[model samples]
Every structure is written in C-alpha cells, then in structure tokens.
Target: GTDFPLDAALMLQEEMKAAFASHEFQEALGALHWATKDLKIAERNKQYRELLLEVQKLIVPRYGFEGTQKGMSLMLMAFQALGYNDDPTVDANTQAMNVLISMDVAGNALAERAAKEQARTSAALKPWEEVPWEVKKVEAP
Candidate 1:
C-alpha cells in the first residue's frame, strides 16, 4: 500500500475547521472546495475513506445542504466516492435515502410554517438557522 500523506491532510482539515470557527468564510470555502476535489492519495485506504466522510460531514450544511440530517447530499457524494452502491443492501444507502426523505419532508414543513408565520419564501436560503447535525457513528467492518 502507498504511504498516503495522512499528517498533511489532517493538518489541512484542522486548519479548515479553525477557519470556519473564526468566521473566515473564504478560507473555509477554499478548503471545502479543495476537499471536494480531494485531499488524499489513497482513495482505497480505509482511513482515507473515513476522512472523506468527515470532510463531507463538515462541508455540508455549512456550505451545502441544511442541518446534517436534513441534508445527505454530501453524504451521498461520500458514499458514491466509497463505492457503497456496489451493494444494494448497504445500510448507508437506506440511511441516506431515509435522510433524503426526511430532508424533503422537513424542508417542506419548515417552509410552509415559515411562510405562513414569518413570510420566509424559501427554507433553503436560511443557512443561519442550521445547527450541527447529529452524526450517526458507524464503524466500517
């Protein structure tokens, strides 16, 4: 196996987290974009795969969809990157689909409520309202 540069990648991830914490949106966006492009060499490596999911968990909501549960778009992207589609019964797929459904339902309900009560025309435009989503921790077998 090739020795992937895990240390550098981890450092970059930490830096991106700090940038976001400091409200340095530009840096965070750059980091998220770089991560989407790829931040590792070992796509087949288990550790690298985990890092990819972490990047997705971090990039989403803040930069993509709504709160984590209400937004599995990045998770779907991560699953695709990990080749989870090769198996029809993979729990990730079912879980992701559940999330997509919930996201849609939650979104519609929120938008309806907001429109009726607060005059918000779109729930997708409210990035300021998203909290960090609950992450379901699953260890790879």
Candidate 2:
C-alpha cells in the first residue's frame, strides 16, 4: 500500500470534494435515488442514516491526520457507505458489486490527483538550468 504524504492526501480530499460537485457525481447520486425508489420508508431512512454516518467516518480522521489505520478505515467506510455487508446469506450482492465499482472510481480519481500534485511538486523542486551539476569522478572503472 502506498502511503500518500499528508499534503498529497489533503490535496486529494479537496479534489474529491470538487468531484462531488460535478455533474457526474450528481448523475451517480440520481441513479442511487432511482434504485432505492421502491424501498419501504423505514428501510430507506435507515440506509440513508447509515450512509451519512459512514461518510462522516470516512472523512473526519483522514482529513485530521494521515496514517495507515485511518486510510484503511476510510476505505472500509467507503465500501460500507456504498452498501457492502458481511452477511453472505443476504441477497445484497449487487450492492457489494456497486461498492467495488465505486471503490475503483474513487481510487482512480484520488490516484490521478495525487500523481498530478507529485508531478507539479517535482517540477518545482527541479534544479534550474542555470545551476551547474557537480560530477564526481571515479578513480577506477
């Protein structure tokens, strides 16, 4: 597992928030809305409440501090928010599949953002052409 620098993680968090405001995110949310349209009121309410808690769980710790445990918890909460469950006997496999797909989408978006930030940072830190390089000579080859 790659450990993103704290700065990179913060940048990713901002990028993800921006993504959530995009039309694509709205469309995805719309799809979720339609999918659950037929659910009983109580069931819908329960799922929505659970989803809210999971989203908060995913966001708070990571934004506050960076660590392997926090990152793992965020990922786990992501899956849960997308409706994953541990019960194999349940017929919610479709929700599990949706979670996997959502994970891929979110992971790719974050990775792309991180890579761009890394590239920008690397370019800024690169030595200017005016700076002379020092080459060490080997006594023997």
Candidate 3:
C-alpha cells in the first residue's frame, strides 16, 4: 500500500531535524513545533499500546487463535513488540478472512481490497497487482 500520510509525516520530521541542525532561529522554531507534535504522538502511542492489550483479548478467541502459533505470537506481541509467524499451512480462505478483519492494521490493506472490488463492479482503476497481465504472446496467423 502507498505510504501517503505516514511518509508525509516522516518527511516533515526530517525537515524539522534538518532545520534544527541548520541553527537558523526562525526555521528552528518551526522545527521545535514539529518535535512537540511528535512528542505528543509518542505519548498517544504508549496509550494505544495499552488499549491493544484489552483489544487482543477479545480478538484472540474470536479469530480462533486460542492455542496455536499464530495465537502465541499475537499474545507475545501484545506484551511486547516482536515479529510474528507465517504459518505456511494456513489456507487462502483463512488468510483472506484474517486480512479482512485486520484491514486497517497497516497502511490500510483495506484500500487494496476495496479498489479491486470497485474496479470489478465497473471500470474504475485498480491497484497494479489487480490489473491483468500476460506472460506470453502468440503470433498472429
């Protein structure tokens, strides 16, 4: 997915840091403002982590992640940030459902799925991966 707002936000952060390093007082004031905003988000991120703890308790059983590796990984992450497992044995249907349920988990996986569905319904443009492509061409007779 495209990193629209996050990338933009990060660019703003970099701009702020550069301004601060430049030692220009006027520009540095804006940079300091940016740093204050970032600090506020940092505080919110910590609270979001706590909220995720309660939310995971609800999701774990509903998604049938009760006692499996997937469940274990999720639980472990709920306590602390860590990588997750990719159970190759998981079927496509289950994978699709998980993605559907977790559409907003990242840069919005839901955007891709919605774009494809809208394209199929009419002729709207779709994400590149959803576009048709041919691997080989046959010469005309």
Which candidate number maximizes lDDT? Answer: 2
Q: Each candidate: what lDDT?
A: 0.42, 0.49, 0.40
Query: Which RMSD does model 1 reach against the true structure?
Result: 22.2
- What would the per-residue lDDT of candidate 3 be over residues 22-96, giving only the tens digit for each residue? 324323233333334446767745543443333444434543345444664654453233211232322333354
Error of 2 at 50 (Å): 15
> TM-scores of the models, in the given order?
0.20, 0.28, 0.24
Question: Cα deviation in Å at residue 27, candidate 1?
Answer: 25
Candidate 2 on 6-122: residue-level lDDT in tens?
344445444445545454553444455555558897886555444434434445455543334456477456545544334342224434434433523544565566689999987
Better of 1 and 3 by lDDT: 1
Point out the higher-scoring one by lDDT: 1 or 2: 2
For model 1, the superposed segments whose C-alpha errors exceed 4 Å read: 1-83, 91-104, 112-141
TM-score of 3: 0.24
RMSD of each: 22.2, 19.2, 21.9
Q: Which predicted model would earn the best TM-score? A: 2
lDDT for residue 99 in candidate 2, whole number 0-100: 47
